[model samples]
Target: MRQGGIVGPFPSARERLGNGAISQSANDWEHRYRRTVIMSDTVATALVVGGIGNFFGARDAANWHEKWGILAFCTELLVLGALAVSRSWAPAVLGQGADEFRRLGRALFTATVVLALGGIALTSRNIKLWIFVAIPAIALVTMTARYLLRLRLHRQRKAGQCLRPVLAAGSPATVRDLINRTRKFPHLGWRVDAVCTTDGLGLDEDQLDGVPVVGRLADVAGHVRRDGYRVVAVTSDPYWSPHRLQRLAWNLEGSDAEMIVAPVLMEVAGPRLHVDAVLGIPLLRVSMPTFTGGRRAIKGVVDWMGAAILLLLFAPLMVSVALLVLMDSRGGAFYRQRRVGKKGREFTILKFRTMAAGAHGARGELAGRNEGAGLLFKLRRDPRVTRVGAVLRRYSIDELPQLFNVLTGSMSLVGPRPPLPEESAAYGPDIRRRLLVKPGLTGLWQISGRSDLPWEEAVRLDLRYVEDWSLALDAVILWKTLRAVLHGQGAY
Candidate 1:
């Protein structure tokens, strides 16, 4: 039982999700994502300790041996289930933006909350504060610190530059955008060595931003084989029909070069994506997002448990923060505003007051100077920030008050970033998909360069996470969010 739980029942690593054609390495963010192992072992060890205690008291249940055995078996299943769910969540979100990462974290937190709440509900015993506090604390500490290490790995990848090199294949325009996006994200770990058009290169062969156009689509396999290119990125180029693509796949087979297709869907995620092998033809299918049955139950449990634990541990700090906020500014210490949440529900989102009392009313004053991209309003160096507020915002201490939001069922420990009404208002119907899950205090957007991201990319990241919700992904995001907090990147 113990062994199986530690090793969650899931497909081995290779059967895992593919990295797509993104050439960025996550060396900088690997430590945080990798730390899930440490947490799993920690959880496993805790269970083992519990079992040992039960063993000594075996005489109490000696007359009913199966009762003890059944309990142990259930515990094992819970742990294993947790471990497997988290696996999909973790890697999928590693080093990217918030959406995938937050979904993963929320999933895990949801599971833990469900387990704790159900245990309390079924048994008339009081909820154990120590267990609630200790388990999550250990997991978060290990998980968060591990996230810090991942950032270092990202830095290392950029330093040694030992990234997998790729040859981009597509139409000139699509290839151009793909190459640009890859260059923008250095940590994605892929180095574009060359570009290949379906026909002979029409684009600047002299330089596609320094790398030359090596050959046409006809030469892709041979060029990759000879140049030792590791990946073949297929963009949404019209020239490559299904017949041509199948042939390319056939030719690229049995080679080390991985063939990747970049689906054109904006903001669509893994769960929304389905591949149906029908009548020998594999068709890609996508489904709408749903949060019913086990999903909602899991989320509710997570919100309560995560909030309770946070409130208990940070009660002292919360007071001190309130006092500081009162002294620092002439406004309420805790700021609450309506934001869009899961399924278009409006809830009061909480934040540490970083602006003056009339910050909301004074929106017109800052409109002309708005520097934030898309619908989100931001300025790299905003003048609205008070001296005390700047400090609070820098370390994200101001957001601590959201523990209440999490507790009150208005938010989650991790999920797509909650968007302000104004931001949501500006969102195209497609972008509003971010509202599929509850907003989080810290998320993929917050951690993955925060305000530095373009508005479109941020929206895309959020939707991706909603579709690929998993426990492991959330753990990975939680870890990364910690590092982003420490570094204070893109934080105003």
Candidate 2:
């Protein structure tokens, strides 16, 4: 079936899109279904929470004696509806989506603000502020429920359900890179079965990782028309002039397929994007990294505060682990190892001993069995681990003692993981930059597959963290650390 270009409806690519009729219609039902589920979920949560609040207040509700329940129900619906209206939720439906969570949480907060403003307007200022507590609490519960739903959906997506088939359009290398990236993060749920490149360019998608190439740049619309591909990701290239690109963009208009342009700038983080349009000329501005001076001060304060609190809270557990270590083997409960730290300073990083006493004293015995990266000796199932140590290491309980290092300013709550002195000694110049900041109890390395990561990837993640340090980013890394710690997939 032939379809007009730019301003016309989309044609079907594969029969998989359904019976060869692929307008927005094929995607519409799923879209509407998702939005409806999200709306219903939020609306239901608002009603239930509001109803419970109203029910408990009905006893002393002399003001609510005249058909108050109905009024309250309507008021709750009004609040929820208003909050939903303020957000852009059409992109996702059901219990969860990333945007859905962001908006729903914000909307719940807005509802609280609205209630506070409404209370202020009516002079209901006596202990009435307690009503607002339900706002955050209910939002948390609702968002948590949505998170569970997202987890389920992600699992389903991983099993190959509910996905968009994409035609990656770029140079073979870029297309493969994009495919590899998207494949690595399957939560985005895109399945690329086709590839297309710029018209008659030397860059062919034929050799691009076995995905079939349908056509080239100028024939993109025609290719989509014939094959029924609904998404085309165009990598940035110099050949397409501004006008030609705009024409290409215009040509894909009103189709089921969406055009995504991937720019060449890889170092730009998502948070750094800003746009300005002066007389219709748009500018894309990138924010500079904010990891020095004042930001460093805030990071220091958080590191100290977090370490102090964690240490205080875990004192009894730490003591128990110490006793276990002393009972299991010999020597002290704590182990001190020289590690490379900030500015290449050598520090004795602390940990609850998870190895037999003098495990390294027998270093010559295990030198041939060095089961780790080039310099660092790590073993998945090391016989050196004491019985009690296995349990401690499994859940990362052994590292909790390192909080002391953090408190003494010898380490940080979130930064690059400290390297062993031997590991540091073998470093290329670039690897030494991992010592630019104090080491962390948990870091990008710990969160990103921990000991399972390749030496190169470990270095890459550390460098990335150093170049893009922020307190907010630190907080995120800490949060991810909790999840990683609990999962403990790669710790041992």
lDDT by residue for model 1 over 70-164, one digit each (tens)? 44444445544665566633544444544444544454565567657655665513224223543454345434543454455457455534345
> Clashing residue pairs, candidate 2?
12-228, 13-227, 13-228, 34-93, 35-93, 38-94, 199-217, 230-257
Model 2 lDDT at residue 267: 54
**What TM-score does candidate 2 get on C-alpha atoms?**
0.78
Q: Rate the local accuracy (lDDT) of all candidates.
A: 0.66, 0.68
What residue runs in model 1 are displaced by over 4 Å at the alpha carbon? 1-152, 265-267, 379-384
Give one digit per residue, the lDDT tens place, for model 2 in 1-492.
Answer: 322211222232334455334434436434644664566566656666566556644435444322335434544664567556856355433423234554665676666666666656655532242345555556656655555655655665565544556777766667778878767866665667677676533344344565667767677777666555657788765556778768877877766677877768755443456787878976677677555688789888988898889888999989888998899987788889998888889989888888887788887787787767655678888888989899899899998988989999999988888888777888889788788888888888888898888877887888878766766467557756878888987877
Candidate with best TM-score: 2
- RMSD of each predicted structure: 8.9, 6.0
